[model samples]
Each structure stands twice: as C-alpha cells, then as structure tokens.
Target: MGFDWSAAAGTLEVVPALERLELLAEPVASAILQLDDERIGVAEIDPELADTAAFCEQYGSPLELSANCVVVAGKRAGEVRYAACLVLATIRADVNGVVKRQLDVRKASFASMDDAVERTGMAYGGITPFGLPGDWPILVDAEVAAARAVVVGSGLRRGKLIVPGEVLAELANAEVIEGLGR
Candidate 1:
C-alpha cells in the first residue's frame, strides 16, 4: 500500500506550518512566513529522534520520503564557503566531488556541528535549507527535487517540516543539480 502520512506520523499532528510557528525555530518560522507556500506543513516530534534513520523508524515514515540537508564548509584562498546540500535519506551527498567543485574549493567537508548551528541559527540535527543565510547556496539533488513530498528538519529538533519537492527547487537560492546525491 502507498504511504499514509497521517498513519505514519503516528500520534504527532501535522498542521499548516504557518499556523504553528511556535513549533519551529525562530529562523525557520521567519523563513516559512516568507515562503508563503500553503503546501508546507509541520509536525511535532521527539527531539531525540531528530536523526533521519531514528525519526523514520520511530514515526513509521518511509525513508524514501525523507530529505536530509547537510551543511558543508570549504576553504579556498583563505575564504570559507558554506552551502547546504539537500538529498534523499536513502543516499549520500557527493560532498567530496560535487560539493567541492560547486564551492570551487580545494576541499569540502561537513561543517562542524557548532559552526553549522551558529551559522544557520538552527539546531545541529535540525538544519534545513529554508532558513540558511541568504548568501549560502542550496544544492538540491535531482532525486529530492523530483519527489512529490518529503519530510525535512524544521530547524529545531522538536519538529519536522513536510514540503513539496518543487517548493524546495524553487527556493530563492536553490540550484537543482544532477548527481548531487549518489
């Protein structure tokens, strides 16, 4: 049978994200207000289950519909570059290859947890592209951008956002790239 979000989400209630800004981190809430996408929704969750695998398992959500946003930092010519890569949970972001090249840095790696949280104003395990700095690039994996709907962090461990993939692809700084996730 096809996935049932209501059943999968268990006892957690999914509601219009804008209606529950209190459940989202400040930055995420602000971003959602700007997005004005009615398709976006939010659900309360256990902060302890913020990680993709754990969240999916605990909520009975399909892993394929989970989107992960990772923060990457690269240094080139004494300048540091940061970007957010959004990919499906079933695969990994090609950080060393695609991300390194995209950032035009000699090396690319996951940003330190402290750095990521500080820069994005989001919890370490709950960073999402929606509230990232305006200057930061948001790399959207082809597969993730093609999904009908996906679950992603709400910029805090206490909640998650459900958004249509096309909405992510259309974000102001989003760049849909092939082979971003592999």
Candidate 2:
C-alpha cells in the first residue's frame, strides 16, 4: 500500500480501485473488495492498451506480474462446461493438455469473444476471474497465485486492477495447479 506511483518503474499512477473503476461489473468489484479494498489499486489506461502485452509495455507492468483470464468451453456427453483459466502473461494456458482433462471433456478451446463478453457482462479483452458463473471452476497457475501482485483487467478496457497474488489464491473455488501454464 506504500507504493510510490510517481517512482513506479512504469510510472504507474494508482488510485483506489473502488473509486476509479466504478464501472466494474458487480462481481468484479466485489471480488476486489472481498480482498480488503485498500489492498488493491486501479490504473487508468488507453482502452487500446488493455491487452496484457500492450498494457505491460505502456504501463511498465512486468509480464511476470501480469495475468490473463481465459474462458474455455467444452462438451462431454452433450453437456457443455466452461472454466476460467488464469495464467501469467509470460506463458499460455495449457488448454489441450490440462484444461481438457480438468473439465472432463473430450475437447476444449477458447470460448469465442462474443460469447465470453456477453455471458460475463464484461468487455472483450477485459475479462477478469471475478464474477464468473458459480458453477465454473477458476483454475489458476500456481506461480500466478504466489506472485506478490498481478495486473488484471477491470471489466473495462479503460483501466486495470492491481492486486496481490494471494488475493487471487483466495478467489471462490480457485484451484491452483502446477504446470497449468506453459
């Protein structure tokens, strides 16, 4: 909480997340608050820089401290299932290897942008692990949950949320796994 934004490696300008990210979906905001609102911060950014690579490069967020929340959809016995996967920016989610087996589905793939955005009530490229459907599992890479802090979307392209990896580990139904990211 003593971060000197002015001296931040990337010139990060942090504000209390609850104040600047009012547009966050109900669930997303609640998740951050559940972690002790004061522990998280918000940084405004060009909507175009919301993606991990651009945001990290522009905001000075390190790839190792940035995480992506991806949605995977699959079917087993004509029953559809979806899960949210959290992986560090430095690696990709091992969808075919781990995700399929985890979901107990024969196949799995990234959900289409249209469906993900519509169902999550969050904009494309700004989906976070917060507020996901209750039945869906949130699979987090072990390394991601152990990070000091990580940057993730704020449910909108206009900003990002800074939270400690421990906050992620506490997420409802979060399953931390080894080799989840590769």
Candidate 3:
C-alpha cells in the first residue's frame, strides 16, 4: 500500500517522483526502486522546511512521523569506517554509546558537514538513509522500524519520502537495533 500523503503531508500530493527517482541521490533512488517495496511515496517540499523540526511543523506531521539519518565515522585499526544512523526525530542516536559499540570502534563522531555532503552527494540538510554508500551499515532504531509510515529526506532539500517503517528495516545492510535511539 502507498502512503496517504494527503493526510501525512497535509496539502502535498503523492506523486510518481520515484519514476524520475534518478533525480534523487543515485544510491537512495536505486535502493528504493530495487528493494521492491510498494509502500513508498514521494512528495515535494519547500527547501526551507527540509530540516526535521521545520519539515514536521510546516507539513503538519508529528515528530514521530519523521526519521533523521545521520552519517557517523570512526576508526578501527587505522581504517576509517562510516555508517548511517536512522532514528526518529523524537529521539537522539546513541552515537558514543550504542553506535560506537555497534561499530566496534574506540570512538565515533558525526561526520563533518563537508564530508557528509561531499561524500554522499546530498545536501547537508537532506541526507537520507536510503541512498547511503554500499559499505555503510544502516543502523535503524527499533522504534523507527515500528512506525506505520515515516517522512524522510528525499536526498534533497526540495522533497521528502514517505515509506513504511518496515521497509526501512529491509534495506540492504540494515541492522535494526534496540536502544539505538535514546
């Protein structure tokens, strides 16, 4: 089933933005389409509201209906390893605790904005877990995976994606973690 964008995003229409999905970052668009999940919907939004709080408030969506994907980096045996952390807007990713432990690294920190934007090929405020690098493990919080539908970035500031929470859990390399969000 598709997302009811009229109710979730207020006036936004659910369109076949995925038909032109290449407009999104290459990785994200490919994942969504290739994953074979039919509960995904795409919609446009004002770039100004791309940030979670602004997007949720402006679109009349609750914080719980939004998920934030952050890029994190750490070093293990002198090799840098990066991963994507997905959590609801209502909670924070346990980066230093659960995340570091999960990565089996001594230290973990959010990637710098320049690194995140340049490497991911997505705007700083518009990074989504869907299009992350192949080697990056997508760490999804249990609560986020339990939601019926979630509003996430479209890999650009001008749009957003609506997908079933279970779909997020099914991404390649996705690791659904309990206590990942705090």
Candidate 4:
C-alpha cells in the first residue's frame, strides 16, 4: 500500500507511558516549528523502504533523508547502556566496533522494537534522535551536516520532519562523527 499521510494523521493519540508527541501532515521542510525545543526537524516518508537510496529517490529529496539508527548494548541476550545513532541516508552506521567504543559498553547491539520504543518514547519504526534522553549519545554523520537540510523521524510512525541540520544537532545535542562507511 502507498503511504497515506492523511490516514496516519488521523491516528494521533498520545501514548500514555511514553508521553511521546506526534505530528502528522505532509512532508515538512526545514524547521519543525511545532516542537517547542527546536532541536531536530522531522520528515514523513514510507517506512517500507529499507535503504536510504530508495527513500531518497521516492521522496525526490536525498538531501533531506536521514537514517535514524538505534544501537543498543544489551541486545546479545542480556546487557545494558543502549545507544542510538542518527545518520544521513547517504551513509551507514558503523554498527560493529565504532559504535561499541563510542557507547563505552562491553557489547553494543541494535535495540529491539520493545526496547527502542520503551526507552526513547517513540513508536517502532518511528524513532527519532530528537527529544531523546540527554544521557543518550546522539551522533550525526558528517555528510548530514553538509546538506542544507535533513529529514528525521516525527516521533510518530507515519510522517517525517525536514529541518536544518544545525537545528537537529542543537536539539539532540548531537556530536558530529565519522566512520559511517558503507
């Protein structure tokens, strides 16, 4: 089925425990003013597309497409100190050694849907680096900064926010890092 943003907009219900806020609408561009903090801007797009290239082609705006990757430490049976990484669509996160070293955990792994949603207060497939816990390290791919704007999650599953890269960095308190290769 094609992405129906209007339909998604209709399902804006506040999740009780997470208290995560959601905004539903067309593909936003540069600055999600609705967010009071103005940290990261969100963009709405198809969740089915697994790769950034596909998302870019479909949206006709590669510069605005970013991949929000959540890296957890306790994914291997049992662990803790989960971390999330937000990178530009043009690059991939270093899920192996780099992420492990950055998070300073004995082992780092991708978080499960339940863990991600519970920790970040965002829905599965709808998590954004914005508004995440301050203790969580937010890393941005250097390439994302080069773009005039970048697209990130809207704290919801349906729509996305396209906002300035600087704004996202400011909001997430993200640190610009390298090693997002392949």
Best-fitting candidate, scored by TM-score: 1
| Cα distance off (Å), candidate 2, residue 75 | 0.5
Off by over 4 Å in 4: 1-57, 74-79
**Which wins on TM-score, candidate 2 or candidate 3?**
3
Candidate 1 or 3, higher TM-score? 1
lDDT per residue for candidate 4 within 87-175, as digits (tens), equals 76556678677777777666666887787777776666656665566677777666665545555566665656555556555654577
1-182 in candidate 3: lDDT tens per residue? 44455545555666654665744666677777776555677887888878988877787887887899999999999998899999999999999999999888999999999999887888888899887888889999998898887888888888788877888898889999999999
What is the Å distance of residue 176 in model 2 from its true position? 0.4
Better of 3 and 4 by TM-score: 3
TM-score of 3: 0.92
Candidate 4 accuracy as lDDT: 0.54
Question: What ranking of all candidate models by lDDT puts the best one first?
Answer: 1, 3, 2, 4
Name the top lDDT candidate: 1
TM-score (all chains, Cα) for each model: 0.94, 0.91, 0.92, 0.66
Instruction: Tell me how many clashing residue pairs each candidate has.
Output: 0, 0, 1, 8
Task: Give the per-residue lDDT digits (tens) of candidate 2, residues 80-153.
Answer: 99999999999999999899999999999999999998878888898998778878899999998887778878
Q: How do all the candidates rank in terms of TM-score, highest first?
A: 1, 3, 2, 4
Give the lDDT of residue 136 in candidate 4. Answer: 72
- The 10 consecutive residues of candidate 3 with the worst lDDT sum are 1-10
lDDT of each: 0.88, 0.82, 0.83, 0.54
Residue 64, model 4: lDDT of 36
Clashing pairs in 2: none
